[model samples]
Target: MRPGHDFIGVGVGAMVFDDDGRVFLARRGAAARNEAGLWEFPGGMVSFGETLAAAVVREFDEEYGMAVEVGALLGVSDHILPDEGQHWVSPSFAARWIGGTPAIREPGKCTAIGWFRVGALPEQLTQASRDTLTAYRKKGPA
Candidate 1:
């Protein structure tokens, strides 16, 4: 049995900020597990025994070939996608860029990647990411 479809999945995300404070985002590809075609805070499913913080850090490195320093928790989101028949508990965090240039390491999962000012983000966003952003905004500082 597969995750998400067979059982609820757990994922981790990061609102990684660059030196200029722009947040990094990735557009989901057709093969994305859910919420394809929408933009989101780059993240992925967590492996067994993996801490959420470590998952977020690994996600950035694996998905974009970048490094990030994980910080305070943003919030936990109940990502229920009825249309896609998938559900996930997503915990997101605030992180800082450590180094490395962003690159799409998984073309099947991500179509485009970029840094955007928080004020001007892509119009279409995944629910999990939207929730994370809302939580982050409410959080303000560390």
Candidate 2:
């Protein structure tokens, strides 16, 4: 077993897609922790007492000022940024937009939020988020 491997964290993420197949992405702020200025789906760390779905819903509200109805589980991916000394196993979900428009509620963490067509996403997407989108495109809904 690897030393220091005992410590690890699990996170949950969301991929909110609209009726026209556009996906919501938010740009991180430059001064914020983790992938700052990079585009990614809205989500965050799962608290001790929250289920994955609940976590996503909470995160969506907190980050984008929106209410999302999370649907099926899309997939999960492991992200380890050795250079940043961060490791996480993130379970991502597919969310259906229910209400509220995207806004930069967490100004310190996020700067902007918008929907982009699946085929033409922003190039600054976080690697894990990109992987999630790729998988989503390949699977093309249930």
Candidate 3:
């Protein structure tokens, strides 16, 4: 098997639902490299040697200043954006908040964070993130 042929980078996103079932989301900063100024699930690319679960937890803390107890794997999506020279295979997961509140932990990547009802997401969500949310809605939280 050719290694790099299917070696798309990995990413981890969290569907952090609150007591009332609202989900956490973040608006990408205007200075981000891709999909700037768009709402998206708070996450980032997994490091070269990182596990998907670990990456999810790390990203949650880094981006949102909160610790997450990751649960079931929600699903995976293979997204390719040739226009932006991006290709990633994202493994999303259902997570529960363990501690801390949403804060701008990583100012370079995220500008704002908020909780919204899953049924009523922001209109400016990133396409890939929106697709993930759609799948989550269809499957319901695990």
Q: Runs in model 1 with CA error above 4 Å?
A: none
Q: Which stretches of candidate 3 lie over 4 Å from their true place?
A: 1-7
lDDT of each: 0.92, 0.80, 0.78
Residues 7-56, model 3: lDDT tens digits: 56666787877777778898898666578899987777787688888998
Regarding lDDT, does 1 or 2 come out ahead? Answer: 1
Off by over 4 Å in 2: 1-6
Top-TM-score candidate index: 1
- Model 3 quality (TM-score): 0.87
Model 3, position 122: C-alpha lDDT score:
89
Q: What RMSD, rounded to one decimal, does every model reach?
A: 0.8, 3.3, 3.3
Question: Could you tell me every candidate's TM-score relative to the true structure?
Answer: 0.97, 0.89, 0.87
How do the residues 96-115 of candidate 2 rate in per-residue lDDT, one tens digit apiece? 88898778887888888889
Candidate ranking under lDDT, highest first, comes to 1, 2, 3
- Tens digit per residue, CA lDDT, model 1, 1-142: 7778899999889899998989999999988898889999988999999999899889999989998999999999999999999989999999999999899989999999999999999989999999988998898855
Model 1 TM-score relative to the real fold: 0.97
Assess the local accuracy of residue 56 in candidate 3 as a C-alpha lDDT between 0 and 100.
85
The clash numbers for all candidates, in the given order, read: 0, 0, 0
